[model samples]
Target: MKKITGIFLSMLFAVTLAACGAKAPAGEDVKEETKTEDVNDEKMTEEKKDDKTSAKTDLNVFAAASMTESLEELKAVFEEENPDLNLVFNFDSSGTLKTQIAEGADCDVFISAAKKQMDELDPNSDTKDSDITIDPDTRFDLLENEVTLAVKEDSRKDIRSFDDIKTDKVETIALGNADVPVGQYSESLLKNMGVWD
Candidate 1:
C-alpha cells in the first residue's frame, strides 16, 4: 500500500510540475540550464512548499457508497504515505454526494458512480443550477467500473445472466436508488433489454 501510494504521489507531483512548465532540460537548453537551474529549483521548491503549506491540509473526498471499501484502503495508505496530507471521505450515493457538494459542502474531490451527478456540478452545464459551480478544468474522468448482476452464493433461485432478470424465475431485483449512478445504469440497461418497462 505504501509503495503504491508513494508511486501515485510521485506521479501526481510530477504531473503537477509538468503542467506548471517544469519540464526536463533538453539539447542546447541543458548547457545554459545547469547554472540557473539550481537557483530556479530552489526557488520553485520553496514556492511549492509555501503553496502546500498555505493550501488546505484537509481534502474532502465525496464518493459513491460502492467505492467505500476501496477508498478506505486508499485513504489508509495515502494518509500513511503522506503524513502532511489529510483525506476525509464522505461515501454515499453519487446523487447524494452531488447534492451535498452543490449545496455548498466543501469537497476537494468528487468521485461519482454516474456521469449525471457530475454533470449537474459542471459550471457550464445547462442543467446546473445557479448555485452549482464546478471548475470545468478540474473535472476529468478518472475511472470506469463495470456493473455486474449478481446473486447470493447460497441462493436457491437460478437467477444468473442479464436475460434471466426479465423472466418470472427471478423473484426480486435489488437496485440502487433511482437517482444513484448504479441505479441509473441498471435502469438504462434493463430498459434497453426490454426488462424495465
Candidate 2:
C-alpha cells in the first residue's frame, strides 16, 4: 500500500510539469502576433496619407531667366503647404528652357517672360528623355514685365532714366539680344520713344 501511494503521487507531479511547459509556447506566440499586427497598421496609415496628397497636387515648373529670384521665393511657399507633392523649377533664359522643354524635359509648368517662346512651344518642340513632353494646348499667360535700363555701378553720368539714353554719350549700350524678351521689350520701348533712330 505504501509503494502504490508513492507511485500515484509521482504520476501527478509529471503531468503538472508537462502542462506548464506546453502553456509557455502559446503565450509567446500571442506576443509576437501582436507586434506584427501593430507594424502592419502603421504602414497602412502612411501609405493612405501619401496616396491622398499625390492625387491632389504636383507641379514641374520651367521659368524664364530674369524671374529666377522671384520663382524660388514662390517655390518655398508652395512646397510648404504641399508636403506630399513636389515643385521642381527649371530656371534659365526663356529661350533655353523652351528649347529644353520642347526636346522633352519632364515638366508640368512653363513660365515664360515673353509670349513668343511659349507660342513657339505651341508647336511644343520641347521634349524630355526622348519620350515625355508637354502639349501646346496647356499654354497660357502667367504674367508680364517691364524693361529697365541699368548702368555699371562705378560709372557716374546721372543717367537716371530713358531720356538720358538719347544723348550721344549713350551711343553704345550693352543690352540683351533681340530674340530675348527683355531685348524685345527694350527695342520696342526705344522705337516708340524715338531712341533707336
RMSD of candidate 2 to the truth, in angstroms, is 22.6
Off by over 4 Å in 1: 1-56
Q: Which stretches of candidate 2 lie over 4 Å from their true place?
A: 1-58, 123-138, 153-155, 193-197
Q: Which lDDT values do the candidates have, in the order given? A: 0.73, 0.65
Per residue, candidate 2 scores C-alpha lDDT tens digits across 122-192 of 54444222232345566666776878888778876777788888775565687788878898888889898
**TM-score against truth, every candidate:** 0.66, 0.59
Best by TM-score: 1
lDDT of 1 by residue, 35-114 (tens): 46776787788778766644426777888898899999888789778766778789988888887877767777888887
Estimate the Cα RMSD of every predicted model relative to the unseen true structure: 14.9, 22.6
